[model samples]
Target: MADRETPGDAARSDRRPLDGIVVLDITRVVAGPFCAMLLADLGASVIKVEHPDDPDYARGFPPMVGGGDAGESAFFTQFNRNKRGISVNLKSPDGKELLKQLVRKADVLVENFRPGTMDKLGLGYDELRRCNPRLVYTAISGFGRTGPNSSRPAFDNTGQAVGGLWSMNGYADRPPVRVGTIIGDLAASLYATIGTLAALRTAEKTGEGQVVDVSQQDSILTLTENAVVRYTTRGEVASPLGNDHPFVRPYGQFPCKDGYVFFGGYTDKFWRLTCEMFGEPEVADDPEIDTMDKRFDPDVAERRVKPLLERWFSAYGKAELEAMAGDRVPLSAIKTIPEVVEDPHVAARNMIVEVPVGGETVRMVGSPIKLSMTGEIPLGAAPAPGQHTRSVLAELLGLDDEAIRRLAGSGAI
Candidate 1:
């Protein structure tokens, strides 16, 4: 926290959600970064700790438009926004001492290091908890902290596979597919954030802290949805059902004149409205497709509804069909990234933001969490590697210019 007049001052002046909270973020890549990012968004002072020799692996990932010494990638920038970075060589004794100093002040400490990595680094939960008994320590792994597969290295791909998400996607005949994005990592991060916040609240009440164990594998299992329920109730291994749902009729994407428009007439009334709106009320009442039971019948809906829906959507343009669909049915005019950027609804919602980077303005998504009292902090472009190292150390750690230069010279910052 800074003095009474600084930006950090305003950030910590009053309890704006998680204000007065301090987090020492030791995570890397998506899962860890995402958890810390959420805390930062909610008003925690998040200090992202990285190694001095190497930075976050995401910093080197490609699609690097601006050339720099750190090779900071766009991926890193997106997830790591609204965080201050510090470099510490945790392998060194002096670095570990520095980390202990940080841990002493942190209300929460989050790490995604594999099972015993932190223990090896001598910053295990048991050790850190001794330093600050009120610290909420969170660990995110591929499997979990305990289990047969606990020690095995896991990433987003492994989580998706074992968690049954991959099995439930794509066409039945085709092989299981990893989702287009890091769904497993994001899921684990979300769970981690939830656990951290809950623990923080509890600690505030009890004056004690606990560990939060979030497994990517377990988080992906959440996506299994009814798969587990069906299996437990009646021994069944569900297969991928393609574009159509196993239990909903006329509830998927249909072709349009230019592109695809997704419509989910998932109920009897929506089905009726969809049919009448598309000038085909006959399909809505037909015994073969009217009831939920028959609508989920793949062979029946494929034969009867697919062709008719296609023709109807083709007859009307995407916009007209969208207008007709209206709020009567769950519908979306399948938009591309650029279309979403330009969409009036998205703009009105303040989803897109223009951030300053040098003299240029970079376009990105603003924080989604809106506060009624204190608003979300306006974000700037991602910091350059160690961009805030000197300033943060001098301000937060009370290190002067000579001390910083000494730490940097020793390669132990």
Candidate 2:
């Protein structure tokens, strides 16, 4: 038997890709925190910079760990894991200077404020670039730095609506529905991370860093797949189709006796096999509905195939239907969050992990990116407000005990 490697082993080893990088996370809420956390997971020294008087607003979000006023928000803990936190009153001159000092030493600075917010504080990309030419400054905004509506405030729902995501979501008859999750914020975060990495690579070679402007709306639009292409090229506007796919038939969720099962068997062979499994071999052989085009035709499918398939699927239990599938077609029961957390495959992939926080164990979603060399990234608990303020000041800014105390007394930190 071989010894199993642990997250501790991975952390102590030099296999982490971003071992020496320092990231100044001056963002808040989901999008910014998510981006910084991703960098931290990859071994960057991410310092979550918060306002001294008021910490990240996500700390107040609901679903607290232990409940009551003292309990930490699970929402905050999930996104901010594996990052150190420091609070500095950016509005104060002393605090601004302290942040500038930290920024000079940082390789990357990520901020998600409305347009012109950083400029008002004299900490914009153009200003920071002067001090640290190699710093990758990423700004995640609602619209963008330069646009007609760039300055407008936007939340997750606003991004989804403005980006055409809502227009194409939900059933065609129902009102446009926002996605269950904050895809707008998450998508922007992923894009910001990518932009930061690319900028970092360029800075390493050329010693010149540029601003990476990521907009939530723009990010959401990018993820709309072929919605824009269909409109522009084919002159056909895409509409909501519930769980059904736009281009393929028998590629959506179907009801079973126990629960709903989703399957996608788009090809002719799989379709034939599906019909045979439903005890309708003659339907598969029917020349009128043989071809993909004919089968997917709205009138034909709505009147003949869909109802028949739905009835057949409704007759069988989920387990029975899964057995009948037998890998000939793609199929699975729609899993809830609880089911997902307990699933064997999720456990095998280390998608759920527990971290110790404030003397309590908190369960959180694990990092998805797996590196053979680095192994699993170490998961740590999110810091309390200004948790690392003193330590960070001492190490990064060379501030001693007296100076740190003075700054705290003056409300600068």
Measured on C-alpha atoms, candidate 1 has an lDDT of 0.82
TM-score of each: 0.91, 0.93
Clashing pairs in 1: 87-413
Runs in model 1 lying further than 4 Å from the true structure: 1-15, 68-71, 357-359, 401-406
For candidate 1, the per-residue lDDT at 241 reads 67
lDDT for each residue of candidate 1 in 181-205, tens digit (9 for 90 to 100) = 8999999999999999999999999
For candidate 1, the 10 contiguous residues with the lowest summed lDDT are 5-14
Q: Compared to the true structure, candidate 2 yields what TM-score?
A: 0.93
Q: Give lDDT per model, in order.
A: 0.82, 0.88
Single out the weakest 10-residue window by summed lDDT for candidate 2: 6-15
The local distance difference test score of model 2 is 0.88
lDDT of 2 at 229: 96
